[model samples]
Target: MNSHEGRPAGLRERTRRAVQAEIVATAMRLFLEHGFEATTMEQIANDVGISRRSLFRYFGTKEDIVLGDHAEHGLALRAALEARPADESPWEALRAALKSLFESLPYAPEEFIKITTMLHASPSLRARQLEKRQQWAELLMPDIAARLGEATDPMTRLRAHALVACALACSEAATDAWVHSNGTIDMERAYDEAVAAVRG
Candidate 1:
């Protein structure tokens, strides 16, 4: 039998997750220190004490290493929304879900500022961020539609698109304001204000 055969499935999955988190953390540190363009996969692997091949197995590209955690956050957001009481309005559910999601991130406001700075300084990274946001929208759209009791029609898709667009715009605005203010402003309050502005 394989070495993992007798082990609990959760143990194997947790181990995999821990390794992946280490790789991403190492890559983020290197990118922040040396700039995204200057950090190579080989350097990350060396820092993480893993083979370059193993790094490639975890992340197909340097951008993937940087943004991999966002994928997990997206899933968490979906789960949060799904678990909301059925009587809650779509907007209320989305707001609560997003708050929970942001609260769960590993970064503090200072660290988030550094990440935002790195992303803004790199053209490729900024592009990749947009692509990942689009993917997040696509991942959430189906669930949003179902919650709205809408069939899979063109109109329903359009409504889902609009909701995701507005929500993301609000989030971006909040983060931008927080970063520009040197994190003196409360991010959660800023986010809530942005959502309220859009709601009016």
Candidate 2:
């Protein structure tokens, strides 16, 4: 039974999500094991027990397997930021909004290192990651501006943009620290430390 709707998810939707999650998990393992560039869609499709044609139905390309969730995450962050109390500091609200990101992490800390390490090492993936960050910042900027009580001043918009950019940078730094330390570091604490230094 699904607590949100008080009923189970439809069989097809549940099955689809399960299959996609399996594909993502398996593909990450493969990408880490064999370099991402070296890994092929056919290989992922084979490993996931689906035909290559069917894999395309779930994810358009190899990169999508890695990044398909970013769009949902951007929307989630925007919604979370909008839900924060009006009096909350933008930084605090952003930090809280990021809880959705952390909560949606699909792998264990150790397994996450594989994904992050691969992304850190790949230029193509890094470029796509930056694009996704820019998209997220754009999505959250309006909510941030609202929280700042800034309506139309250009400077207000710029400040909101800066805050969103800085928050993302802080997140990246913390994730990098955690990955470099082989996940021994607490990511949220690392993020807090980065923010403290940035704010100081």
**TM-score to true structure, per model:** 0.85, 0.86
Model 1 lDDT per residue over 104-198, tens place: 87788789899998887889888988888888788777777776776488798888778877887788888889888988998778878998998
lDDT of 1 at 95: 77
Q: Against the true structure, whose lDDT is highest?
A: 2
Per-prediction backbone clash count: 0, 0
Off by over 4 Å in 2: 1-15
Which regions in candidate 1 have their CA more than 4 angstroms from the true location?
A: 1-15, 147-149, 196-200
